[model samples]
Target: MALATVGGCGSAEPSQQTETDDSAVVLPIIPAGTKADSILVDKSDRTLILYKGDEEIARYGNIRFGDTPEGHKRFEGDERTPEGRYTINGRNPGSRYHLSLRISYPNAADRAYAEARGKSPGGDIFIHGQPNGREGAPLASDWTDGCIALSNAEIQQIWETVPDGTEIYILP
Candidate 1:
């Protein structure tokens, strides 16, 4: 039986590491017992913001996405990060990337839309860190197959703050 690799950032190719003179990336200090209830990703701005109720808790800039990085993903290999509301359903501590939070893509509407056209609605979207064993600065361009990418340090912060079942809204 042929096994299929589902939703990961898809490429084994190493993204070009960046060299910057900017100061080290600093994560915002969340107060003890604080947890994020929601996440928002703005594709046009390339940012991911975490929220606790109506208050903003953390924001990650320079977030990377699929090569196309323009619109909602409808089918497999579209190279587009999905837009709309999704839940963070799982966590991957042993991911190929540093750490990952799974996004529930292909909700019923997504599946119907794709199946209506006789195409598969790909699943397995995630918000994850830089690929494992990668060092230096994060990649300088959009690189993931469809999932969102963050720096290793940034992901560590997110991993701690975002629990499973958090609602995420990805906006184009």
Candidate 2:
């Protein structure tokens, strides 16, 4: 067996345990009953905004789109973000791209649109953290399978603030 230590000169023993006291840390807790009413994603500005009714809860810029990065996502492997109204239907804290909040893509309209063209309205869209474990990675490009990309830190804040079933509007 072998052990790899981070930032170690030679010896691999850790100086401190990897745990924190919630009570001791002055955490920025979300307000009680402060539920997010909607999420707005502006493709032009590359921004994602979280709102509680009329008031803005949190907003993040420098967002990334898909690899193709233009217009609505049509069929499977389009590599384009979708533009429509949807709900945050599912959550995955343990995901391949860090934490993820699943978007309910391929709604009735999308399915119909694709089906009419004899295509598959690809599913499994989400607002997720950056690649490489979603911990802390600088975003460099629009490269995804039609999923919105955010920094791991931004996703963490969103995970805490936005609850499932909240509405999301992705704009073109």
Candidate 3:
């Protein structure tokens, strides 16, 4: 499938650097006070990667998604994580989850597609941590309504490193 890309939101584009030896994964050297400008979510791999300019800053694996986790989300309650480009539009410290970074899903194309079918394109998608009152290892299965999930510590790191308006590309 063709990868979907959107115009930059006035931020630097992200690029991945690989070692000459294909088997080795070279992590980028990020200076102190640096922040991620973009994020990439690979649904098939269940991973979320953070990038700064052309360098990968961090990569979180074992990410979880909605119960029905494949494919682009089309309507409310589909339980499918959306596939495409979006932005981290907001954050919620008081969210029921440990911490949350909002994703700007249901873009123009999403709305049009759902409207044509007379269904509501769901909103309120986010990348968040475990439930606020829960304490332990992360859940073992796909459980969100349609949001991406990470561990509390992982989300805390992401919350501090990623700013609002960071571009995110969710892929299948």
Candidate 4:
């Protein structure tokens, strides 16, 4: 099966703002900020990767997907992971996990599908870390509420690398 990677072909592009110094100025800190292109989740492989454009900047292993990885999410308590394109909607500093990045699920298609069935497309999908101080759990088992699971260090790396509103695509 092909990896459910996100985005089309493109080079890694960091939105940089170059500045000039006036009297041999010394830099204090360098910022590695870039516009996040996409996040790839391979449930079969249990890996979550962050990409800037097409370059893989950070890869988090020991990740987990929905309990049932058969198809896209259908309804609440389906225990199925969502497939297709999505985006990073928001961030949660306070979460059951150490931290989380919200995924923009229920896109127009999802909404329409749910609406057609007269059901609420269950929400609150996230790319989050393991339970508080238990970041090691994700490495042990596939435990999550339908959201992609990562470790604390991995989540922090993602939190710092990708900005909010970045496009994320999850495939089957």
TM-score of each: 0.88, 0.79, 0.82, 0.75
Q: Quote the lDDT for 105 in model 1.
A: 91
lDDT of every predicted structure (CA atoms): 0.82, 0.72, 0.77, 0.64
Model 1: per-residue Cα lDDT over 87-159, one tens digit each? 9988777666766788889799999999999999887788988777676788789988899998888887898
Per-prediction backbone clash count: 0, 0, 0, 0
Q: How many backbone clashes does candidate 4 have?
A: 0
TM-score preference between candidates 1 and 2, better one: 1
* Model 2 poorest ten-residue lDDT run: 2-11
Who is ahead in lDDT, 2 or 3?
3
What is the C-alpha local distance difference test score of candidate 3? Answer: 0.77
TM-score (C-alpha, index-matched) for candidate 1: 0.88
| Stretches > 4 Å off in candidate 4 | 1-31, 133-139
Task: Rank the models by lDDT, top first.
Answer: 1, 3, 2, 4
Q: Compared with the true structure, what per-residue lDDT tens digits does model 3 show for residues 18-129?
A: 1122122233345668899999999999999999998888998888999999889999878888999999988766566666677898899999999999999888788977
**Per-residue C-alpha lDDT of model 2 across residues 72-116, encoded as one tens digit per residue:** 988887888889999998776545554678788879999999999
